[model samples]
Target: MQFMILLDMTIVNVALPHIQESLGFTEAGLTWVVNGYVLMSGGLLLLGGRSADIFGRRKLLMIGVGLFAVSSVLAGAATSTGMMVAGRIGQGIAEAIAAPASLGLIALLFTDPGERTKALGAWGGITALAGTLGYVISGLLTDMASWRWIFYINIPIALLVLVLIPRMVTESKMVREKGAGLDVAGAITSTTGLFAIVYGLLQAVDHPWGSAAVVLPLGLGVALILAMLIIERRAKDPLIPLRFFANRTRSVINTASLFYMAAFISYTFMLTLFMQQVLEYSPLRTGLSWLPLGLGIGVGIGLGTAFIPKVGVKAVAAVGFAGAGVGLFLTSMIGVETTYLGGILPGMIVFGVFAGASMPAGTNAALHGVTEQDSGLASGVQTTALQVGSALGLAVLVTLALRDAMGEIQQGVDVDVAMTAGYGLALRVGAVLMVVGAVLIAALLERVDTKLRDPVAEMVQHTA
Candidate 1:
């Protein structure tokens, strides 16, 4: 279930160029293929968590899995851009329901904290593998079959999850405060605010920065987000309580987590483009090229699991962030003629190593001192942060890349070269984002110690 939910996040990326050609998507509009899924999932994740608490976990799990399977068919059969986006939106909603429920069930099953830590460690590993597998499997499917098979692949997995839920997983207990109501307003405002901001950012690539077309939506989006916060403060049963973020240490970890995810996911997005577009590697080759990264991550997660008990979580996180920042800086040096081994391979391995190291520490920090009931809610919020960060980072980096590419085009550079240059610009800035995360780690998490953890693994740990 975790694999099915997280894999969809990036499986489409390797197939993006093909999907664009097949569906005739405009360059600017292609991002919606990703954003549509992420935005809805990110927007509704908190509500989805609450829904699990109000409704039965097993019931929501089956509903979500069923919807996911049905949408996979819809996406696989899509013949137009609208149809594709609709399918993706359906997927986002399904994922919002199932992903948290699936994860929450994991926590409920592992009653012992020691055993739970090991379970979450395994969870961390699987989550990392699923992320890279999305690229590998998507590339294989696109090369050997049709890109549409990316969507087709999910049906069997979802069906299996449906079958296994009843047999292998037990229903979790539900909690409802007497007379408390859902914060429907918070959900609407946050979702619309996020959409508005993304839309404005994407549009900025084409229009002037100060254009009302760009500014109005951006302003409205910020206003709406502020409104969401206010509503959270006032709501009887807040979709996302503002108090949830009041822990200074947790707040800092999450902030750093957001930046960490922004840089980490941007690297995935940019590197895939770099290999396919500039290096002109086939999808299979491109997918295979990431094997070192996957291997490094596996190794790092193993090491961090061992090291965290000895050195403490924050120390490991600090070192991990520092290493990841350096890796991204090295990646930023890629040129049109750069070789894979020197230019791409080492950087990927380094970043992968650091990402693995940071995962457990970050997870420990996020879940430290939290009680059982709110455990699911904490996990859901962290996942939302991961998705929102990934989406926002990709949008910002794409906007910057496109703007740079436009300038290069105006200067009469070849479109392909210009595009690579644009990606390079995004990559260099992505390096800065990683470094910023490292700084936050040093300042915020270095002295903190977490003795117990409550289900902290992210899809991004990724927030895995």
Candidate 2:
């Protein structure tokens, strides 16, 4: 269920253009279709984590799965822009509920060192695989049927998970004060603040910075964020525990993950459009082209899990980032005449391997040395970094694309040249971002004892 949700988020990217055409979305509106879900999902993650802690993780999982299923159906049936946006918002809410709870359940389920490592490796592998394959799946679905099917496909899978969840998953509640309460004020302020910030960023590409659509929301968002900080400091049960940042490795890893994801998400977004618009590839062909990359990620994860402990998490993570940086550099060289095998495949394979190896190592590093009590919050924070990074990356890349395209038009370049120029600019920027991430990983991630087996094993055993 966790893998599927994560996969769906990426898979929809390949279908974006088709969705835009079919739904008659203006450029800004189309971007929102994707950004809306990410914004809400990222914004509410901390709250969702707290909810899982207060309620039972299993209970939240079941509710989240059901909500996601219903939202998928609604998205598939959407006929207008409003309907689609509404459905995406629902999907975001559902994801916010499900993601952290699912990770918490994983932490609970595996109580042995070896078993936990294997489980986490599997989880990381699946996440990387799903993210890469989302493009392929979205392309295939969009080509084979309508873009609607990209969403509709989630329905049955969600249903199956919903059924299996109740039977297989046991309920566990957070060990907290009996009278602990949800931070209502914190939730409202944070969610609205994030939404406003993201909305402003997205609008900035099309509208001037001083424009009402851009400035007003951006200003309001800053104020709201300030309000949230004040509220969290005073709240009895804060939605986000600021103290978690005290762990140097955890804080740095999360920051690195955000930057890494920004590069990754932007690459996926720009690459999809490049394949269709510049390379003139069919959706199915584009999807099929990614098979090698997806498989490579799976292979890399397997290898990393086997060898990383022997070397070190920091070493493995550094290597992975280096490989990803190289891949991004290669991708930046893509042009209109570039062939899939010659131009894109090599980079894809490199990226796949890096993503596969890095995600598990990064995730393990981020959560390492944290107490069991803070595990749920740690998981939520990691997930929030990913979603927020993705949204922010896309926003930044899109802005660059728009800027480059406009400049080319002003220079009287042909439409094709202008569009390709925009895409190339985004790719170059993504590559730079990846390099930055690599440097951070190399500098900040220390040599942790990876052979501790499962860091959470002792805690889980005691609880059980």
Report residue 132 deviation for candidate 1 (angstroms). 2.7
Per-residue alpha-carbon lDDT of model 1 for 1-464, expressed as tens digits? Answer: 78887677778888888898999997778888888888888888888877776776788889988999899889889999999999998998887887777667776777676676677678888877887798899889999999999998998898887888889777775555678667889989998999999899988989999999799999999999999999998888899778777776677777877788778777887788778877899988887887778778878888887887788777788888888888888887888888998888888889999988888778767766655566666667777887788778878988898899999999999887888788877877877777787778777664444433434442236443
| Candidate whose lDDT is highest | 1
Per-residue error (Å), model 2, residue 414: 1.9
lDDT accuracy of residue 146 in candidate 2: 84
Residue 424's lDDT in candidate 1: 76
Question: lDDT of candidate 1 vs native?
Answer: 0.81
In order, what lDDT does every prediction score?
Answer: 0.81, 0.79
**TM-score result, candidate 2:** 0.93
- Give the lDDT of residue 301 in candidate 2: 88
